[model samples]
Target: METQLEDLRQQLDKQCLINQELQRQNKDLEQRLQEKEKLLQELQGQYHELDGPSQRPSNEPEFRKSRAAVISSEPIHETLDIAGTGVKKTVSETSLIVKAIQKNDFLSRLDDEQIAMMVDLLVAFDYSPKDEVIKEGVEGDSMYIVADGELSVTQAGRNLRTLNSGDVFGELAILYNCKRTATVKAMTNVRLWCMERQTYRTIITNKSKKKREQLMGFLKTSRTLKDLNDAQLSKIIDSMDEVKYQDKDVIVREGSEGNTFYIILKGEVLVTKNVNGHQKQIRRMGKGDHFGEQALIREVLRTATCTADGPVTCFSIDKEVFEETIPIEHLELFDDSKVLQETKAPEKSGPSSTLKFKDLLPVLYQEGRHQGDPVTLGVGGFGRVELMTTLVHGKYYAMKRVSKKHIVAKRQEEHMLFEKKILKSIQCDFIVRLHAAFKDTRYIYMVMEFCVGGEIWTKLKEVGRFDEPVAMFCTACVVEAYAYLHKKNIMYRDLKPENLMLDVRGYVKLVDFGFAKEMVRGEKTYSFVGTPEYMAPEIIKNQGHDFAVDFWSLGVLIFELLAGSPPFSSSEPQKIYAKILDGVFKYPPYLSEAAKSIISKLCRPRPGQRLGNTKNGIKDIRHHRWFSSMNWHKLRMCQLDAPTVRLIRKGPCYINFDRFPYDLAKAEEEFSGWDRNF
Candidate 1:
């Protein structure tokens, strides 16, 4: 009987333990539900705020006008004084700067010469104990390297960390215009070597500009390359590799297989020929002189031996790169037998006749109007997209209806017009075509080519992530689009899966040009605009950015496609920017070395060093091992099968997109005449 009582007691203990576990799990689930509800409420508030423009301030016209004006109207053009007049540094100070920079991720990418130049530009400043070295929420223009003593970092009255000698601070200031994030107070008497943003920009800009100009001048004077246009010349300049030779060094040996074309930048080269088994000097080539044109045209043995007369620096391009940039017919000009004929430029075609605003007016307002309701394809912060069909032809197009009141309230008038201008100007197969645009008193409308396969973002969400082949194919389509745009001197600032849409054929088409801007070659725009996760370090710093910013975003897109998330992401924009500036992100183990390498090259902190930004332009990216099997020509022509083909439905379907409620209301006040030309 005692044994039976003990068994009952053990059973009772087990039941109590199980009950306790169930209660704990229930509590956890309840907490999670509360958190989810909070998040959902926040999202709904944002949605309403975006969809309903009436809540936005209507009496801030001056502020709205000034907002667009804040963007610099002129490109920054600061020339460095090359007279060797800069801050003089002591040997110890120079060593300190070097050490400090080497330990910094942002500055470590600089080459030895650039580092030396920056070190020469550093000015010394001393701070006393308890003094504020830098304050939070103040725009900073100078970066400092601690030469001695210690400092304390604080943000919002909270102690963050301590800094010692060799530590760097305010580095972003030197890179771009940004408010200091944290306050730094000197804990001891401190000496810092500082560099100003203007000085730093001058050094980088002058160096790059001078080199490009010199190479361009050489190419322009070359008889073999004279037929090439400025754009083609730029490509050649980017592909050329800098080679230096010591005195008496043989640059080319007679009778060796030659396939490289050379242009001398500095020093001299002595051209000699083997005459009667003896090397006899024939001619001397100096700076601006070019040789070996025949080698690029066809495979041939070197006819002459060229030796460096002294220390010589020359730009050399491989035959493959040379041929890729210049057409074979153009290269054939090097041969006397080939006639140099002028090729007539193709006639530029305007927008399609069927896409005229007048033609679409009937469909939108009269006979072809929808009998009941239009299909809401997608919704966005500014407006919504709807599926519109013409009755007579039964052709479908995506009509983007943006609220003018929302645009004005958000101070996006300039952006809206600019987007229309850019869309109308560009014509590429990989880019969605803008068929028509017209605005009413209430909203501005854009008729764009309907993409049936829908946003890559939606597809990615459904599948979680893409395999290597799919990612590569998608990336390739974007590459083609960017190549076209970059060549036209346009920068597509916003690149995300949501902006990338697939057609019925599963080919990717880039949509949305709200942030697109045309920047002249070698010029930088100081616009701090882009998606947080995809923004480059330069863009985050508000430093001047050019086409290079797009490449950085491209890297992020590639990572997101393969890994299912961007390399740097956070719930907060500030955290995302911090991660971008830190330049530390993990690559998934499943990613191939080639994929990682291309991503790394594209995501370099220095804009000038990014893969597509280099002189080789987009060729470096195209030739990357990750895309070794890519048939660029075929892809551009849409001949290659897209990886998303299996996922796409047949003709004019919206299966990939989520349906949104038609919540847009009529404008309370009319916005007249601003969009007359749209």
Candidate 2:
């Protein structure tokens, strides 16, 4: 309810601001109308004062000659399709065109006689009811005025206003090579009059010195080319081509390689991305927005697909021109490979076994020596982890340093204590080993076993979605870890990809024990915690939950691995929880029935009926049909080959480890009793 209310408030504020802007424009238009009327009266008075009755009817031929002089030097063909608008007008429509032009603001500045002469250059168009007359995001070469019927103005899928007979639009397109600001749809079968770019320029250029001024004005407003030097801007101005688009055309495609960068000149377009299997609309790009420039720096695929909402237009610069014009500094983009810890042994090296906590402790703690200036590995609300090395043993480890202030404020002292104790006691090949805990004035720190492969979350995204075998390998390790923790009566209340890391050998290990709790037989805890996507129905419903919750999360993780989205995934938390309670989701056609069956049995909303929660316990999951062909013993001994692979090592900088160097190390505050048990 609070989220919905906040969203409504933001939308209301946005609409109110737009209404205020429209009010200002309406006032200015009114003031301009009054001034135009005054100017017309003054012109009439001057005509009478200068000519009087001496002006003769025979001078009509000379008057015609004066009108002809205002036309373009290079004559455009009459009775032609203007700028591919698909509608043509003949001299027969001159009077009607002139009358429509007289009602427009900027074009209305011309005298009736001048407007009549422009009839040769103007085009007439007919649109059926609901026809898109002008599309937003599309560059337009012509400006339109409603000769009859009405049109609706829309932007970003929202209707902002309406236009009736004599209302002018698309002028910005004709005035400059830019995207359409909004879509104009024919509300009724409409007759329209239009003036193309060349004709509009001739009208402005022949009358005054506004040609250079207008081009300069457009150059100033360009967002894509804003970073270019004056010389570069000048070159683009001369070489840029005029392109046009009609309604519902595709501008760019996601995942396809792109070489051109586009800046909208006119019209609105919808930006969408492939989220799971759906076309998720991300945003609407209108005037001034630049797209496809990221492709210019180096080879990369188009990140989002763009389609015309209606008719759209824009300026496109090729890679060659962009590279030359835009000065790109040589900066190395962060390689994701560096973010994971090295987990694989070198070629010819034998199989590596998981080291014991007792063996790694001495390597982590050096006598009379401290770790070097910390290079941050990662950070979150839980606190920060940094790269640390020993002086005597020359071994490396991950040191998780947490702020005491945050722990005290959130009243999580008990949770912290449980985490430290649980981590120290657990001994599983697939679980991260906690060597020792210490404290200073402002922080409590833990020295943990370093897994060269970074979080599985990072690896999962890189692969898009995992294949069944890879998913099986990763999940098997997690299942074994859960089996161990459950035997010790420690419930892993939180389970997700972010807390799982891969070692150099591509073996997975569970980390972070902040949410783990010890529970004896017939004991249940009502701790309302866990990630939204994987949180069990019982936790969300405030019902007491047990180790079954971890199994529920495992099902969600498996689904995410196979389909790239959780079965009950939703942007809204309430909707997600509702979906979870309903406990229903369609399996993709490509997903194996075996995988579906296991997830269904594990995620059963009623904990009593859920798998793993059965009397057989964790063995119910380990012995499931999905792992029927597996040798669980080999996986425990790190003998199973990973479908997606990496090998890594420990060093001053493990390239596989992520770089997030934030210095949380502050002067030690004196808090002796607060960290005595740490």
Q: TM-score: which candidate is best?
A: 1
Candidate 1, residue 277: lDDT = 83
Write candidate 1's Cα lDDT for 473-548 as tens digits. 9999999999988866679988988889998899999998888888755455655566767888766544457788
The parts of candidate 1 lying over 4 Å away from their true place are 1-75, 78-85, 111-113, 136-139, 154-161, 179-181, 246-249, 266-286, 308-312, 332-417, 424-463, 468-493, 501-509, 519-559, 565-678
TM of each candidate vs. truth: 0.58, 0.45
lDDT of 2 by residue, 41-107 (tens): 5566468567762253331111100000000012223223333333445555555666666665445
Off by over 4 Å in 2: 1-373, 647-653, 664-672
- As for candidate 1, its clashing pairs are 238-615, 238-616
Q: Residue 158, candidate 2: how far off, in angstroms?
A: 16
Q: Cα deviation in Å at residue 72, candidate 2?
A: 74
Model 2 TM-score, 2 decimals: 0.45
